[model samples]
Target chain A: MLAMRELSVGFAGGLALRRATLSVARGERLGVAGESGSGKTMLGLACLGMLPEVAVVTGSVRFDGGELVGAAERDLRRLRGQRIAMVFQEPLSALNPLRRVGELIAEPLRLHRGLSRAAALDRACALLSEVGLPDPASRLRQYPHEMSGGQRQRVTIALALACDPDLLIADEPTTALDVQVAAHILALLRALSESRRMALILISHDLRAIAAVTDRLAVLYGGDIIEEGPTADVLAAPRHPYTQGLIAARPTLSARRDRNAPLPTIPGTVPALAHLPPGCRFAGRCPVELPVCRSTRPAGNPACHRGGP
Target chain B: MLLSVEQVHRSYRMPRRRMFRAPPVIAAVQGLSLTVAQGEVLGIVGESGSGKSTLARLVMGFERPDQGRVLLNGQEAHRLPAAARRQTQMVFQDPSDSLDPRRSIGWSITEPLLAMGLRAAERHARAADLLARVGLAPADMHRYPHEFSGGQRQRIAIARAISPDPALLVADEPVAALDVSVQAQVLNLLLELNLTLGLAMLFISHDLAVVASIADRIAVMHHGRIIETGPTARIVSAPAHPYTQALFAAA
Candidate 1:
């Protein structure tokens, strides 16, 4: 199992993330959804021990009996490809431009497993096939620029799975992709997790994408985990007013919008880090907001008014 | 018609020539035609390279069509006088990059008005009113783009687009940047504006479910041509084109 406790971090005067506590069971997919500055990316990178020097992390992170928050740099480096793998947001930028596709995919296996060249090559091709890449062998020598966006993303997935790690954390994995290609890649990931029984952390802003993939969902706002519950329940009837507001505002289920309809708009923007509200972070924009909302933070509850067990 | 794109055919001149005999061409858009009635939304849906964006540019008058015509309110859109064409506006996909970071949100929102020679006091009041209409408070006019979240920044973009009360609004994948819930909010805003202003819209997106929401009529484009077009409910429930069916199936 992978879990976090009170994980908090921030960027130069901007609170990127805050008070985040989430977990993923061995065979489940946990989705982390939030906006640009909401700290979703910081939390993911912090887990990989890759946070920028400016980011100050304060919290405990546990994965499969090991701790990540305070682990030494050298030890964390060893743990990365062997125990956990991260598929970055941008495929082409994350990958080495000069390296051939095959070699790049096999890099983790070569480093962590100390496999021979032939063995690494064989494993790379298998991993490529697993990501649903066509002509895996024929594209071994292709450069990153030579491949399409979908292909490059597939190769990146192959690289992350080089070691078949227990935990896979993907941050905004398909942000740049269109729906069809994004869906195909998502299905590929699901298949991979089912086959390997690996824990998956899918971080994205798109609820539908996460809804189509995740087993449980956590809504991140103003750097805090406002709500966490089963995906369907949370989606169908969100408990937290903020979650409800998000639903009313999205176009995903707004198939009934006609000329006479009222467009649901969430009032106000998220408060900045330097200006994190004294009460609920979302109180400023909450339509059902009460006086207490501006004076005190609400406790995180699995049972909120909108959707709860 | 607020905007009209008729039989637009844009072909790129491929690089390299043996002897400059004739340049090879890559057809980006071929025989494409689209119209947006005032306050009516026409959704353009397709995958990358389907030429949906090219269609937007042609309608925006940023790119001249290689063939056919683009008329805005019964006149040439791009070729109209600067003051006349300013009646049209656009809201881009990514608000972060689309907005000018160096300037405050107030400046960016009122800049267009300033360029059009609106009095500073009037433009300021108009900007504030526009902000409130899009769900932001009038007070937020002083904040920079970096101060708001993705969803809120998008609101700012919407306000900027509608500040001039342009007859036509072209939004290219407006909600694509947002989270599912946030996307719902933005869509709701657009839908409301569509009702209130009766503003004609060209809503371009790759997500079928999104187009299924606010679009009055849906056009499915593949390669450079629109393979199918119909009302939202009919097109979604009973897509005629094989590609449209496949798209729905994949989604």
Candidate 2:
């Protein structure tokens, strides 16, 4: 349903995404995992043709037989909220504080489906209930502030699904919610994608959340797809040093290690965009940094000198 | 126990909108009690509005409990002398926010020492030593907080917290704001410090995995009360409380 080939995005001096290639089949869920400056969000935005004007983008972004790169503004706008939807990390700020959630959700319906206000509102209530929000009728009248963090996120999800888009790009959708609420939101996303046969692009910094919902995993590090494979396979034995570091660094809920021993950590911070290393972005902090890793960028998915499936 | 709280209850009065109406009371901590022995880490795990932070404030003597007492080394924390109070320090969630951006790292680390009437030169030397102890170079002491990364800033915060050689350290979601890889560095540092310095820690966080990793005993809080408290192994393996089970499942 979605394919990105050699999609590169660059600013004045630095590259945000470098020759990144990714694809998601219909009803498939792909997880893009990366830290603060990894440019995972850039990849998501690029898919929807939402990169800022200052950002120079190249290569092909094909979604449902349409090329998004250099597409006309009117065409992009038509596809943005109607055919390709997005859910952000912070729902409170993403939603309008002054507008009623019903109107907000119904606005897309009325605009795209050309429905009357009353009819769109009725559909909006159904969507609210579909996202598992209780008291859907009364909730339509409430503002974003009146709801809990989880409810607000649910409303955001409802708005994204309002147009029944073929693909949904959820960027860190549950990062701000509590653990229980996050779990519920992930489950809802999973179920919705499965039932609706919608392709999902879940971008998150958290490995656990990614591991929970995604079928395939793409590990991004400093604007590159360092690893891509089945989620279970990659998680069971991560080949890339960065992937291994991320997995080891996470404190598992079930596995209890020695309390006195220090946890294994990736030394050095993620390099700033302007100061990124020439070859492998992670080489500076990688434990098994080869000399060649400093001069030549590794090619292909699961990009690494060391052998990994 | 190195530190203990007995039947502590804390509440805040909401401002009344109407002149004739009485202000409503919201209990932040209700009959909460726990302890941390010497060199033992007691993890306080709770979601937002669960009163875990309120408990930390009460333990640090930042807020007084309306009903019960918070005893640190058999003396009330709020009632302790100025010098004695330095024995218990806190490491906040955001190191950048807690540390003054204008001051040098050395100046920030040695502030507690200066308060204890130490000479300026001695304080500077101690600051350098503290930085080295937290796996940072002594030269980093002259740099400001903004010069360091999130993990390094947390190290600076930890160095400052332990500069006074406090027996107890209350870290309230210290690693919550850091990235995963950076969070591991900070968590490991705390674990190492606990072992090397024999410092007791009250590790408060909403992350169950992180709490289970470092805590000797875990206390699960909900709606201003502790629902369950037990050894880390017991809590992870077989939680008796339904809320604890739910928390584990959620994590």
Candidate 3:
């Protein structure tokens, strides 16, 4: 299982993640939904030992029955790709400029499997084909700049799978892609989990987007998981008022927003890490907030997240 | 009568290596003609590489069309000298790349004043004034880009774009970098600015939803051509073109 037990991450700005906890099972896909700075990306980075240098993380981070949160630097490096892998938002920048497409895909193959040059090259071509690239062998010779945004993101996915790791973490992998392409990428991630039984951590701001791909969903607000449950139930009928506001705020069909209706905006901005709100973190903006919510923090109970749309 | 794009066709010839071999050419923009009245908001929607940005750069006078002309208030913009090019400004999608990080927001917004030969103190006062106009604290002038959120940074960018009080502003996917919560704020700001300044705008983006509320007229581009152009209401309700329909379906 992939798990974070009472995990805490703090920075000079303040406590960005406060005693957070969650888990994912084999072949399971968990979607983490939050606002722009709601500690979504921070959680993903913390798991891979890639958190910003200033972040001070405490508590236990474990994968496949081993502790990782406080693992030694050298041990973390070995665990990163061999056991866990991540694909970031911007694939173009993440790719090395000087390396050939083939060399880039062959990296993790060499790093973990220690495959020979010929074998790795052959596997790299296979991965390109699996990701639906045309003329997989030909694309291996091109650099990142020569490919389209969608094609380049596919390459990033190919690299992430090179190690055949137990867990895959994708952080807004399709944000820059066209909708058609984003749908294809999402389908691809689901297929990978089905065929490989790899647990996946998918993070994005779009709830409907994450719902379409995940088995379970976690709603995050101000560095805490405000709600968590089965993806279908939560999206179909959300218990949390903030989640409902997000639904109403979603861009309608045809992308035509109504000026007549007031957009259901989350009232106050997210509290800075250095300045967290008392009671429920969402009390400032929750439309149906109770008076008790502002003075007392709500416990992250699974029952509170019971099945809404 | 704020902006007019007249039959603008921009093309580039492929480099020729042999005398006998003729180089192929690529046409980025076709014979496109449009007009933006004062206080009107025009939207240009298309997939990436569909030349929406090329059209934006052309209107901003950053790229001169190979054929046809661009007129700002009945004055020629393409052939204008660099100083006159300052009359029209642009807000790019990536704020970080658009603004100079080494300098304060105040210096960046006041830059065009220097180019236009304004007195130093006058430029500072005008920039600070524009800052308030954009809903930002004037003291924010001393802050760095990293200190502000994506939406606030875009506000600064808008303040800088309109610092010279240009008749036309071209925002190229200004809110695409922000989340849904913040996209609303920026879109609302643009709408308010249009109503208040009546400034003409050429809003280019891939996200139709973000522009639908603010755009008066919508132009849908596909594969380097504007396939559909009509009022936002008409286009959204009954899109005539297949690409626009596909775009609507995606939204």
Candidate 4:
């Protein structure tokens, strides 16, 4: 129900996202995986018309046959909470300290759905229960500071779900959480998407979390989508060198191997956006880069000169 | 043993919830004990509020244990003199926070050396040498912390930690802030340093897979206690404690 064709976001620093083409169907789960400065978050922000003031956007963003690019602020505002909702990494920052949990959730419902104060509060309590928060009635009266990190995250999820959005954009939603809590949140997101028929875009630096929750994966590097395919297929057999490097670099618990050996790591760090190579973004770091890779950009699904490694 | 903690106990005072009531004390660490052999890497895995950072502080002698003893090289760690305490150094989670933004990378790396009463020429030479050792250009030492990327800044932090030629390194989530590729590089650097310099390390992290990759021994911490401790392979292959098993399962 959503599509982006050659969408790019640039500022004074340079292009943060470049000619990105992507789509997400209703109830589809798409994972955007990248490190810092990789532009994964930018993709999500662009979809919601939430880019910074200085940001210069180009190309098309179509949602349900309507163009979102250059759309009126009034139009985008109406669609934001009602149709496309977001959950951030830090739940505490997303929640207001002065307000009670019930009010936080109900405000979105009242604003978007125009429900009565009493009715909206009732829906908020149900949303809390649906998102697996215990004792929804008591929790409604509690403030954000009184809740733990995981509980706060669940409340934020409840707030997002209060409007019954068609699309949910969770940007590293579990990165700030503990391992067990993170796992729980990932599972909750997956379950909510499936049950509500809500499309999901799970953006994270963690490949394991993405692999566990997402159906399709798009690997981003230096403002470009280096690889995009089925999550299972891409993980099992990564075609791009960057994808291969990322998978190899991760320390695995289930895998059996020598402990004394150093993990395989990609040499060098990601270059600054302005200093990025003219050709392929991955050219300078790719293990098997052809000469042409340094001068000419590779245009394909894997976005590599040496495909299917 | 390079380091030992003998039944260490620590608690903190929490504000009173009710008027006219005595403030309650929460146990941060309780009767916890462990030992690290020379050149060994002991990984402490725990979630937030599980007392991992508290343990690190106790080891670094930043906070004295309310009860029990922390020993480094058979001496009370907290009682060690200023010069002697330099033998144990720390690398914190965020390099950007640990590093001074205004100072040159060389200045930050050589601060410990300066405190040791080293001459200017000697400190400069050592800083340049240490930079190369951590896989950075020696010439880049003059640049400020902002000039370097996150991974490079971390390398600078490592270089600073090892500048005093410490016998034991306490790294608290050193690679947690780094990317996967960069995380692996830093982990390998720590292992390499441990091997080449015989630097015993207490590596603490919430990431099970990361600790598994580097630690010779793994200690699972829960509710201010060591629930499980064993060789890395055994801990990874078959954890005996239910908490440890749950932690691994979550990972």
Winner on DockQ (1 vs 3): 1
For model 4, how does the per-residue alpha-carbon lDDT over A150-183 read when each residue is reduced to its tens digit? Answer: 9999999998888889999999999999999999
**What shift in Å separates residue A209 of candidate 4 from its native position after superposition?**
0.8
Model 1 per-residue lDDT tens digits across residues B76-111: 766888887777789988999778998889878888
Writing each residue's lDDT as its tens digit, candidate 2 over B1-251 gives 78999999999999996899898989999998888899999999999889988998888988888999899989998888888898899999889987999999999989988888999889988988999899899999889988888889999999999988999999999999898989988888899899888999999999999999899999999999999999999999999999999998999
Ordered by DockQ, highest first, the candidates read 2, 4, 1, 3
Please give the distance, in angstroms, between residue B56's alpha carbon in candidate 3 and its true position after superposition.
Answer: 1.2
TM-score of each: 0.89, 0.97, 0.86, 0.99
> What are the per-residue Cα lDDT tens digits for candidate 4 across B106-135?
999999988889999999999889999999
Q: Give the alpha carbon lDDT tens digit for every residue of B189-230 in model 3.
A: 777777788778999988777667778899987766788999
How close to the true structure is residue B124 of candidate 2, measured as C-alpha lDDT?
81
Kindly list the interface RMSD, in angstroms, of each predicted candidate in the order they appear: 3.0, 0.9, 2.5, 1.1
Relative to the true structure, how large is the alpha-carbon lDDT of every model? 0.82, 0.92, 0.81, 0.93
Query: Which structure is stronger by DockQ: 2 or 4?
Result: 2
Residue-wise C-alpha lDDT for candidate 2, range A52-160, written one tens digit per residue:
9999999999999899999999999999989899999999999999999999999999998999999999999999999999999999999999999999999999999
What local lDDT does model 4 show for residue B2?
80
What's the DockQ for every one of the candidates? 0.52, 0.84, 0.36, 0.81
